[model samples]
Target: MDESNSRSHTEEIPEFVGPYKIEGPLGVGGMGRVYSARHKVLNIPVAIKVFFRDVNEKPASAKRFIQEARLAASIEHINLVRVMECGNDQDDHPYYVMEKMSSSILLEMKKNGNYSEREAIDIGESVARGMSVAHHHSIIHRDLKPDNIMVSVDGLYKVGDLGLAKLQDIENTSPGLTMTKTGLGTPHFMSPEQALDAAHADARADIFSLGASLYFMVTGKKPFEDEGVQAIINENYEKGGPDPGGLNSDLSAGFCQLVKKCMAYKPEERYQTMENVHQELIDLRHRFHDSVKPIHFDTCFDLAGTKKEEIERLMEQHAKAASDKPKKEPVNKLYIVIIVALLILLLFLLKYIAL
Candidate 1:
């Protein structure tokens, strides 16, 4: 079950975290509870994630969690969730303010039944751009799933829970972590490396997870067979993959090929980089957009306004450039005219003498 809707923090007493007023609980998790908070004075809404458990009690876990939060905060991109602030109050339990996503795509799709292939491709393109933007910022989402892909009301797509799985990466970071050296992840979504040995993981590991999500969108089914968490993870050790082509004829050959590359047993065999996968998705979007005629707004009026502004800016830039230059040589126009008249008379005198 999804956490966003099921969890609400409305009834909690002293409805505030830091400066933001906690209007309600957004959701709950094993580690913490998320709240819908509004800034006291600014009244800006933010998602406040309050750690319900004592992370300090689990030192490495705490560090990993903090690292994830810090790393996420450092990255500034449209698709990625933005971190606002982090601090603790009198209780000493910590919470951080972050960008609130409108809703999860997984929840929405499940609610609406499977989407048409065209819609799926469009969403895929948006998600790819978001991921590409993150990769450009040197931050891998680490955890890319349908639940993490959130869509805003006006068609803005955001990737949430950036590096949320980083908490599991902290071997030195958490002594009292989750009682395991290997990290934990939901079944069917875990990359083989993450499922077997986390140290073998890297950015492309996210590509694998993305492929799994893409497979789900197209087939309306998870990539791997549903099984116990341990059982599915054990299969990761064995390195098994689902047969994408067998299930859906609607799945394009290129799409399945990319998915196959993504779910490759060897990480090297997967997409070389996140950008590579993003490019493929982008190319696919272009083709799809081309096939389905797009609405291109004629900017005659808008373009005219834009051009006017641009010319004004250029004129300002020209003036600034002119002002920045040192004073030029003042060539007297009258003096030049006088010199020309003298030179003309001299030429006439020379011509008369030659005649």
Candidate 2:
């Protein structure tokens, strides 16, 4: 069972978690509860992710939680949320501080339906760019989803929540938690390899996830969605991916093809590196440079009219002018030719008269 969602903040809300004071609850997940906090002296706002009591009760889970913090802290990328620090409270629960984002991409998605082609591609590009850095360091974000991606007020998209991330090197594994053949990660976005065996799941698994996430961004729907987690996992293992273009007809062939390549069932068939996905998105953006638009509208248009007659009169005049604008007289080539000929004859006559 996914404990992150089941478990609530068991411990009483403390005024402070380490040096940071808790402002409020951000959200709860399968692993732990996240809180909006601020540094005592610095007064800097940060997000503090703390493991639940049940997770902390187990040594393996505690170590894994801390490991997630360290792994995230190690990776430095603008597209990724920065881990500021990690610490333990008096209760022995593990928690880590991350740079707080103004809002999450998931929240934005809920507010606004599907993202535009350019917006979706841009978000995908940023995520792939961050994942490329993680892959370079042998880290794979097993649970890459819209909910895990954060968007800042300044329009910067970043990858966050590395609880399910796996480090490539086995020797660097956390003390208690061992990377077993057990499958881990969200069922809907999981790759075949990840579903079959998480231990062996590699960078390709993340590629599949990124593709799935991209599909969701453009279509406002999950590729493989079912009532049960097992059902979704089974579908991902047996069936082909849902056509992104089918849901969003505006999507181009290149966009659909890129998505299909990413969501390929076989890991070998999918993109081998995050860099490849990133490059493809870059090219896609270039292909539609002229049509690329701002991710969000900058200005709002007020439609209220102060004077009813003034508005109606102006609209009527505009419509009348627009209707008449294209009514052009057809030019007569014969008349033009005759006029030129007559002018030439008159010039000759004038010359004859002068002579």
Candidate 3:
């Protein structure tokens, strides 16, 4: 569920949904309200998303809601939220139970405005891993924003909220759920193709969204900041957002390049699969740990005059020079000295015999 949807309301909360006792409201989405709940028998904490009866009455909404639960529950990945069960209440309102997350990436961003480049990469990688699994299962997560990514108490990032997910295999059969040129997904994080036609968006679309999310994580700003939703969508479709490195000079060139590739205007230009994105993020994490250092505020002020390109070039040269340096061979000075002494002793003995 989206944390941004948390709002005070006058509606009475349900005491129980199926076998789980509803504790409190977690957040609300377009189709339903998420509540923190516990299993009556096991006392295990869980999150239950109860579909609004009015919305559930609609055939399209009902199918989409149930599909979301089924799709999420089918995939069993550590980085993806696990769905325990789904059923209808006495009032015929549909609800699905999932493992309750401690928090979300959205909450983390709210508490901490921006994340370090490393932190952003870690989050991106986790989400990519989850998306990779979904894509493998022919599921396209149209909405891959921070609000949909949850973080557990153990610091594990889990991808959730597949309410807008597109199933490639069943899309043709379910034309009602097929979003056409209307453009689904968050404007700021959606890909150009998705903005044009969400129904046609493939795995690369999710890659673009993930990239945009990473951009937001590191820069503390939306990829495309516009006055309105349509303008934001236009910016994403016509012109890509500004460079992440420019927004946050602390970001490394490699990391910025990764984001740029992910946010490519054309789907073909973006990473072909979530696996590719995951691998690149893994590589970036390794590079970050091996050589990259987080730029501090003091360091930024110290090198205020230097351009990012110059710093990157210098670092590249330094790394290259270090790698290209030749190793020195060992020398035996004692052996050389011994040989010289023997030669001198032989010469002196010959001279004395001659005398």
Candidate 4:
């Protein structure tokens, strides 16, 4: 939680923020509070992210809150959370309207321990496409993690908090002022360069985080883990991490290699752009599909049998059909002779007519 700088408060939550009637608090984080609300006029449900009163007092935090809205709004991609409106409330607290998502990727991870390789790849591709849009506009989502990746109501993974990483390291300098620090973003998913020098980190840093995220999704473990934050950072920045294939033996070599490339210690070695990562994931998916043979049911069976029993029977039938089918057979000599005789007779009759 980044609420270390937030001041304690006991005031009752507001019933409304402008035209939207506040339903309740959905989530509260270091950035601020996300409230579930509905527009009184349109009766449409929306999530409103509002800066804490203490956070709003700081100009630096306020600037970041506004920047997050602008940065997210600039990229009109389906895989990104849609920013509807942003401004200050009557009390001057910064707030932005966004489409209400069902939950965060973290929640999904908890509900279903580590997705299958294909599910992880599919989600990773969707997120990469979204980040590709941000990278194109020169905006790096310095903080890319499962928590920041939201699941839309429609089940699409949407990346949120695009520009808030810049403010994540803000320290409360005084009563109403905050100062940015050299370090920002989650330590678990930071690229080597990003962990070393966040201010200078580029799009490659996002690729590393995306890889780390996918690594977590498929393996159900972070790429690097330690009791101390510094220890984890050192491991990621220095030794990198273990081969994902070693942990998840079910993963193909190509998929494992692709993920390892993303977490490369050297930014230059990593995928140069989010587009490249996206394309690679797409290609990997294609390869995975091609490698697996589709099961074709030659005959429909009754539902009386168990699924496993039915599958076993189908396999047996397919194998018998494959083995019993003739590989080759000699052509009938009698048919060939009949064709030759007909041709000879037709030629003889034509010659006789000519004579």
Candidate 5:
């Protein structure tokens, strides 16, 4: 057998991609292989995804892949996965370099059935923030499943896998455009319109997928799910989802309403923007926390700005800029309130102690 044909899909990675040393295989899929690599001087860990070394691969496919990488590398949002660099190997196998994040995905977490209502809502909103950034750049994360969402060490999410996502303003929208014929994305998370007419899908498709993800987080199962992809598509075109409040008997009606709104059959009926979806999540989380009444907001903000790149970059690196800005004194309003309340209790205690 030919060595090329004999190589397993999960074969060991080469020593280097250009200059970066390929440490090992990270993951693999039908499209290509991802490897853990290291920048020689920078020592930065990056995940490099590469296509198969096939010279006869479709021109459009390769072109679209490269374009997506380039576009993704330029978009600088904290919530979205950052593409540090991109290039093609000697065999014309294109690859991208990206910061390697902690690889915990929501898909794996959903299996445990431990998602509280507030956590589900927060996940939905965090993902929406990333989606909004992509939408702003005229890009749609056509594949918005939990596997594509990674939570970093600092507990912030960075949306990954822009490989299948389409840029709306690109020339590929014109006639004779070649779309991914089969399995462009995960069937479980696709919107009805996307399942039916993928090309016609826009940002709204992402909103529906986010709803599906949230549904899984909330209910621990897919609504309108099926054993096969075709069946799933058919079910999606019809009505969708488990009866929210009825299933869990723990979800609030307001949160259920929001989920249903996100899963609207028509794009027009769903969330108009990701920002709106995010804001709803924010409000819902706050409401849930309010009922609990013992939130440690101080601890939450203790290591504040630890995960924010822009803040540290401008504030620390550029001393002049930080000096120019008026520094405001830190105020602990919550602690002050607590102290005042404690003082009132102490006064009552004094009278009781005296008696």
Candidate 6:
């Protein structure tokens, strides 16, 4: 058995939850406990998230859990975790089954230390692709952290755990479902606007969280750190974190700029859509790893606060430098002919003298 899916001796493992047999507890979250389970009839491995009895007693929590299932199940993207089924258990608690993942990004990070710049870019791109689809459907993933990104056995990175997602078209029918309270999401990764009012968060909010998560992946440290939760939340709200490149000097300037743009203080300053974020990551990959050419002017221009005059000046200098570069002169045909003639004459002279 994989160490990640090891049975938890602390919690009692249920023999069955609906039609699935619980093999062991995968992990516990704020609203539910996930378990490694198998379908009773098909015998296929799956993950079942069963809500706590207290959560089921609360209408808001129950509604949110069901929404998570419905929203995730409706989307079909390779980069998003697939929801198999959702129903209630014998104990009257809500439960949802999803495809079992090999491990989460958080677990992988802990096991393999911090990811390199290239690895972080790959993970960020996959997440952006998945989130872009969700955004198109008018879903805002209010919570996006390494813990919510799962890695499959085949090494595909998938975005999971959408319990806190905000659907634009959906109404908050439950009395307490409105996220008017402050500090609604994970403090370290939440955007400033989201920390203030999660109900109004949009695609840009998810971009901010993705930037924070990428910062952690490269630097091995959370964007905001504090002794108290409220202090961290305050830091995220009042003051933005340091540049990711400053933490990890090995990261490329373009990548650092991309991350900084994503974590911009205001939503308007950040990338407007997940598709834009994905495209930036793609450009970063080419600029940092694949291409031997200089960074694109438009890429630098896209970064917030980058001056147009400076970019144009730099591009002009690059062009001038290329034009001024000295080229290798071709071998002189006359010189080669003279040398060959001299060699032939010397050979003839030596042969005649010997005779």
Tens digits of per-residue lDDT for model 5, 94-116: 88888887764564575465477
Model 3 Cα shift for residue 283 (angstroms): 1.2
- Model 3 lDDT tens row, 1-355: 3333443264478898899999998888877889999989999999999887555568888988999999998889999999989889878888899988999888988997889999988998899998998998999999999899899878899999999887886667787677577678888888777777788888888998899888888888888868556787677667664579988988889899889889988788788989898999899999889887334344444565788887777666666766778989878899999999999999999999999
The residue pairs in collision within model 2 are 4-29, 4-30, 4-31, 5-30
> Tens-digit lDDT track for model 1 on 1-355?
5442233333244477778887876666545677888999998988887765534477655555566678678767777677888887557767778877778878887788766556666666677777766666655565688888887656677787754444324445554543343645555777776766554466777788888887787777887674865676565447555546668776666667777787776788888777788788777667656664222244224444456567556555655766777998899899999999999999999999999
Among all candidates shown, the one with the greatest TM-score: 4
How much does each candidate deviate from the true structure in C-alpha RMSD?
A: 12.4, 9.4, 8.3, 6.5, 14.7, 11.3
Q: What does the lDDT come to for candidate 4?
A: 0.79
lDDT of 6 by residue, 237-349 (tens): 57654588888888888888888888888888888999999999999888776543354565565657768777666666676777788999999999999999999999999
What lDDT does model 5 reach?
0.74
Better of 2 and 6 by TM-score: 2
Clashing pairs in 3: none
What is the alpha-carbon RMSD of candidate 4 to the true structure?
6.5
Q: Encode model 4's per-residue lDDT on 1-355: one tens digit a residue.
A: 2343232244357898878899997877566777899999999999998778765677767776776787788778899889999877778787899999999888988997888989988899999999888777777788899998999988898898765443222333223222223546788787767766676678888899999898888888888867455776677667764578878998998888888899988888889999999999999999988875334453545434559767767667776777778988889999999999999999999999999
Candidate 3 error regions (>4 Å): 1-10, 292-355
Task: Please identify model 6 stretches exceeding 4 Å from their true place.
Answer: 1-11, 171-176, 227-230, 233-241, 291-355
Better candidate by TM-score, 4 or 5:
4
TM-scores of the candidates in the order shown: 0.70, 0.78, 0.79, 0.81, 0.75, 0.77
lDDT for each residue of candidate 2 in 114-169, tens digit (9 for 90 to 100): 79889999999999999899999999889898898899758899999888887887
Q: Runs in model 2 with CA error above 4 Å?
A: 1-6, 171-176, 227-230, 237-239, 290-355
Tell me the deviation in Å of residue 116 in model 3: 0.3
Once superposed on the true structure, which residue ranges of model 4 sit more than 4 Å away at CA?
A: 1-11, 163-181, 298-355
